[model samples]
Target: MSNLNKLDFTALEVSGRNYLKWVQDVKLHLTAKNLRPAIEEATDKPVGEAEKATAMIFIRRHIHDALQTEYLAEEDPRALWVALADRFDHQKDIFLPEARHDWQHLRFQDFKSVNEYNSEVCRIRSLLKFCNETLTEEDLLEKTYSTFSASNIVLQQQYRAQKFTKFSDLISVLLLAEKQNQLLMKNHQARPTGATDYDDGTRAMTGGSRNAFVELPACVIMVGIWVKDMTDGRKLDVMSLVSEDQHED
Candidate 1:
């Protein structure tokens, strides 16, 4: 046999357990014998050959794109936006042929667990579909709004403030929170780093023309006020409520 065809099946280091599990999962999703063929065919050649690499890349992209649909079901525009931001800012690294400074290079620490990362991959793709929608569908053309109860203000605030500049950062924060919680669980209850009560009042006005008033934390309030002061037209009309009773009056 030629040198190219002389590859040994015994030496090709495929994980038997993982390979079996992966095959089972594929069979569950797709009736085709994708895993069996993939494995059987691979036995005749080297794993990282050019054709195999290309195929692997294609499969990874398809899987990553499919996972991003989760945020759509939530119907939270901001959440969807965050999901896209997460993919662009975090998860694209593994699939991208080259790394760019502008594009986020996702790190291991950015995810709490592999499961969370996998979930986010799906979420980001779903959000991309939202982004690609027409202006009307995006709420720029036609909007919707919902009012929250007085008790929910605290929750609204916390949710808005915790949203990072990029969805990736937000995911990183969550992962960090989860990791810290785990540490706390292991040791006696000790607070984690960068863990703060991010209670700031702001809810998604949805499709409303009324700009969502996000009353940021004490640290961000001054920055918000400064930005508001500089704006000429109607600015983000955010007000601080010192106490719960203040809403009653």
Candidate 2:
């Protein structure tokens, strides 16, 4: 009875297959203890006193409020189990379509991380499986790609080009790609403009060019304002000023 208390049971309600699964779990536990006869219809022989007591204990502990009032008066555990099944089994039909819609439309949102997104996908997959509608590996892969962030262009492209038989492999690649993206973003933010390495392995700006720009701290902003004033007041083209400056240099 102490061990039975530890066994998890989903509360029974008007809707969902969770109650059916919970009942099945309880039945298995009873079967393992050689006490299944307590909850099963008695044959030619009468049920033992111990079996009846065990079954009653189980029902009293696990039965939900929605079902308690109706089944509480019943002395036979097997009859009570059957009554609950007859009333709630039809709920699978109602839950199936809803689960299908939810699984089909499930997408990774910006606020969720990769693991969080994967957990939701797995959760919906489980619901679909319970409804006898399991998605194929290819279908799951496609759905995963479809829901992935549009910003993950490189990862998306790599996924398309690669040949991955297992969804786990794809997830591994995606996690690695996400980490690499984070690292690139961090490096980009930390690096100073003109300090970034060029294709030739040299800094973007030479030492002299860097010094010239640094010396004229407000030059770029001042030039932009001057150009706007000249353009509005004197009808001067911005390109002419640029060409004049280039020639002077």
Candidate 3:
């Protein structure tokens, strides 16, 4: 790729199928490059000619060849931005309803992981935002709370009891719990099975008991925090620890 093509985001296509995302990417990059004023209607201070020229070049580089040729006569970054918006801004009209449908059906329990759920929610939220629909923190929280799978009633109740006011706080807590649970699982897998601890800190394999498994009761809390039976949503207690002991002939 040419050095110009080595940009953070790909050039906007002529079809404008990805117009919404492309606009967002361009705005973010422009802000980062301190060229935002080049396209803005008003600025705290006058945007220098050199800055406007740089912004014009940047905007041109991130557009399709057809678009470049279409607006070759446009020298002003602000004018180019307005032209692009006017040409492809109709994408929101086509995407808003679809975004709403996805948002209405979004379920936290439907996803296998928190990260996936978070990503989907953010994507839909961005689309809604583009359509002038605001998704509040309360909306995010309610959507998450209401979508807990039937098997996770107890877990859902536990999270509700905490009364998380912000989506960020709730997601942060869930991510931490998941990380801790994964670490505990890694430690458990690394430990040898059928090895019991003695009073003097010695470990020995039980005789003729290959199926015997030791429970780290202290660490089970990590499992209880995140993992729940999809069958019953039952909070498995320390006393109800699951054993994966292997059987040997």
In terms of lDDT, the best-performing candidate is: 3
Give me the displacement of residue 161 in model 1, in angstroms.
2.0
Model 3 lDDT on a 0 to 1 scale:
0.81
- By TM-score, rank the candidates, best first: 3, 2, 1
lDDT of 1 by residue, 145-216 (tens): 112235556643564565334444444554676688788787544445333333233212222221233333
Off by over 4 Å in 1: 1-156, 189-249
* Error in Å for residue 83 of model 1: 34
List candidate 2 stretches off by more than 4 Å.
1-7, 14-21, 24-49, 109-111, 176-249
Q: What would the TM-scores of all predictions be? A: 0.22, 0.59, 0.70
1-249: candidate 3 lDDT, tens digit per residue:
254457778888898888988888988999999999999896679999999999999989888888899999999999999999999999889999999999999999889889999999999998999889999999999999999999989988999899999999999988998899999899788756433334122122334342233344332222233346679887654223323223222
Residue clash pairs of candidate 3: 151-233
RMSD of each: 24.6, 12.7, 11.9
Clashing residue pairs in candidate 2 (N, C-alpha, C atoms within 3 angstroms): none
**What lDDT would each prediction earn against the true structure?**
0.35, 0.66, 0.81
For 110-170, candidate 2 gives per-residue lDDT tens digits of 4356777778778777766766788888877887777767787666667868867777788
**Candidate 1 overall Cα lDDT vs. reference?**
0.35
